[model samples]
Target chain A: MTAALHALLWIAVTIGLYGAADWLYRKSGHRAFAHPVLLPVVVLIVIFEASNLDSAKYLASTQVFSTFLAAAVVGLAVPLYRSFDALKENRVAVMVAIMGGSVSGVISALIPAWLLHAPEGLIASLLTKSITTPIAVTVAQSVGGIPAVAAAVVIVTGLVAALIGPSVLRLVGVDDPVATGVALGTAGHAIGTAEAVRRSDVMGSVAAFAMIVNGLATAVLLPLIAAVVG
Target chain B: MIKTLAGIGFLVLLLYAVDGIKQALGLPVPSAIVAMLLLTFFFASQRRVPDFVDQGAKALMRVIPLLFIPPLVAILDVRAMVLSHPVVLFLAVTGSTLVGLVVTGLLYKALVRKRGRV
Candidate 1:
């Protein structure tokens, strides 16, 4: 079969699998383990292994999906726009929250890597853990880390943060909606912001702002930190 | 449907345009991030977001999780390195993420109190 044809089939399969996973997640009362993203990915891996399909070929065909990921990032602007009033009013607090979060995110990740004696490559990947995937993968690549590993680590970090972030926020006395949004977005990126928006429109917009600012901050801060550490 | 498609098309164009500019300028930020920033700036400048654009963006949001699968599945290739030191790696990533959340939340609480309602 032509490569294009091969890709078409896989794309259809992927979407079908994802739809099924989404249905299952909803049916199962939205269990974490049945995560639409995670569960579909797991199923894909098993199917590929069973069929002996070349993983690289599948990836090559599905490159279009990655492009959509970029658009999705741009789509985030809608929420920001929707929450413009709150964002404008709290610009200073937002700036402080993101800067504080971004800097601490880098430090918190790096210190543990150093203490654990992780290899340079692993440390490099860990550096981008708090940022969103596209930027995180790019940052990882620039710093000599494995991009795939970095992307995986980024997703896992977001997932874990999204799962536990709200409770942690409450425990720490972060009762304000803006604070909750900023905290989740800064630490969890889009995945965390997904949960934040569920809380309220105000929370969602602030969270989106936090996620975007944090990404930009990490793009600049991480490289500087890497150079300094070296 | 057409409005949604048009909105999506507009976003994709903006994303690629920003990416092109980043490549031309040799900027440090990734194109996706730059696109988001540029879009946000543009939207904010407009004062009122278009109905079609808002609807389109909302549609895209529903599919965001699907877009992530490709990268997550790419993990199969690097499973060896990740699994080699699972304990330490997991600790570093998850532990730092939690720390970031707590520290940021706490700092935000203090700053909000000090600034008096932000």
Candidate 2:
């Protein structure tokens, strides 16, 4: 097969796989484990290993999806714009909570990995674990980390947080919608925000606000911090 | 459909412009983020989301998760590194995420209560 045809074939397969995964996710009532991104990724990885196909070739073949990822990141502006009123109402509280969460999130991830002597690339990737995947990938690449590792770390973080974040918040006496939303979004990004949305509209909007702000702040800050630390 | 497509085209154009600016100015921030901020500002200044932008953004959001797959699949390349320290990595990710969640929530709740008293 010509290179272009090979790429097109893989792209079709990926899209088909994603469709199946989405169906599963819906069928499972949107369980976190059944997330659309997880199954297809696992299946693809298994296929590559079984066939001894180069992962890099698969990544290259799906380059168009990455471009769409960038466009989706831009699309975030729409929700952010819609959430401006919520943000405006409690600007100080929201900003402070998000900043605190973001700082502690970065530090908590880094200190453990550093003490454990994880690889430098892994350590750098951990820096953006709390942010959404696209911005995390961007920051990871900028800071000399592997984009793939960073994306994986992000998904893991989001899943962990979404599963337990609300309970943890309740244990700590954070029952308010705004606080719950802010906490979930700050820690888990999109996955946590989805959970927050399922709880309440107020929670959903606040979570979306916090998630976007946290991502934007990390995207701007992580690279600068990396440069200075180096 | 036409408006949504046009809005997407406009967004792509904006992304290209931001990329150029990022390169010229040597900005460390991602162009997608810069585009997001600029688009947010544009909507704010207009005081309403244009139909095209709203439709376009919704269309894009529908399939955004699909975009994440290719990159996540790239994890195959570093499976060894990840597997080697699975316990430590798991602890760090879960611990940090929990700490972040609790701290942000409690602090926000405390601040809001404090404001209510005042």
Candidate 3:
């Protein structure tokens, strides 16, 4: 394919795919589990891989989709900016929740591995499981873990949060938008935030900041695990 | 504009010593994840951190799906990628996720319930 044609084709597919995803999320009443970000990509990954399509071929055809991703994420700042007032007001509580959530999240993942007698490598990679993919992958690799396994775990972790989080929150009778967003964002990342936005702008906003906070906590905490596990 | 630059700058710094650090530490890490956590913490402590960097980070955060696609796609026959011990691995992953979700959920509530969010 000509470079122009390749770019055009990729852009068209990405936009088309994302459009379908956006519609799905909107259709889902903005639930975290209904996030368009990962689901469509998973489907696309399935198709591309099954068809034996090279990533370079897919990239040549799909680079345009990144524009969509950029727009979506940047657009998130709108809610993030708007909720600054709420975030500022509850900054202290959010901080504590983030730290607690981070430790709890890592422990949650690792404790299971220990119970299952999962290797030290699996446990170490998962210690950063709830964080974003890039971070998760790197953390997984750092502790003599597997990046691919970490990636899968990160996806599943986020997916589980997106799928069942709200219902759980409701079950607990917690309707506080701040808690909802922070919890989802801390545990789920972009997908959670999308769901958070659906729940409430404040939740989504808190979720965004929570993501940052959790990342910070993970960075500081994981190295310590290396010390303690020693 | 500024945010884009900040994000780009963030990426550069992230890519710089993280690989070396990971290698030097000879840790079992995937260098990128460690770098992300470090950046996140560093950004966390600064007074309100740079909104530019935040803006930049937010953009990167958005298309996170894309990052995931490449790898999952690379796996080709993922079912077969299970490396002959698929059940064990799947259990390890799924088990960890369930534990992570339920525990983290309860812990967050427990930690801050007494604080009474504002």
TM-score, ranked from best to worst: 1, 2, 3
Clashes of each: 0, 0, 16
Pick the TM-score winner: 1
Rate residue A145 of model 3 by lDDT. Answer: 72
- List where candidate 2 sits over 4 angstroms from the true fold: A133-148, A162-177, A190-205, A219-230, B24-26
Name the docking class for model 2. medium
Candidate 1 runs further than 4 Å off: A171-175, B24-28, B115-118
Task: List model 1 lDDT by residue over B15-52, tens digit each.
Answer: 88988888899976778777777777887787777877
Residue A230, model 3, lDDT = 69
Chain A alone, TM-score per model: 0.87, 0.79, 0.76
* lDDT of candidate 1 over A122-170, digit per residue (tens): 8788878888888898888887888888888888888888777887778
Judging by TM-score, tell me the better candidate of 2 and 3: 2
User: For model 2, how does the per-residue alpha-carbon lDDT over A1-230 read when each residue is reduced to its tens digit?
Assistant: 88899899989988999999999999998776787777888899889889968889888999988777677667667767777776665779889999999999888888878888888988888888998876888889999988877888897788778767887788888888889999988999876766676677677668878988899888878789889998
Cα deviation at A139, candidate 2, in Å, is 4.1
Model 1 misses residue A14 by how many Å? 1.6
- Candidate number of the best DockQ: 1
Candidate order, lDDT descending = 2, 1, 3
Higher TM-score: candidate 1 or 2? 1
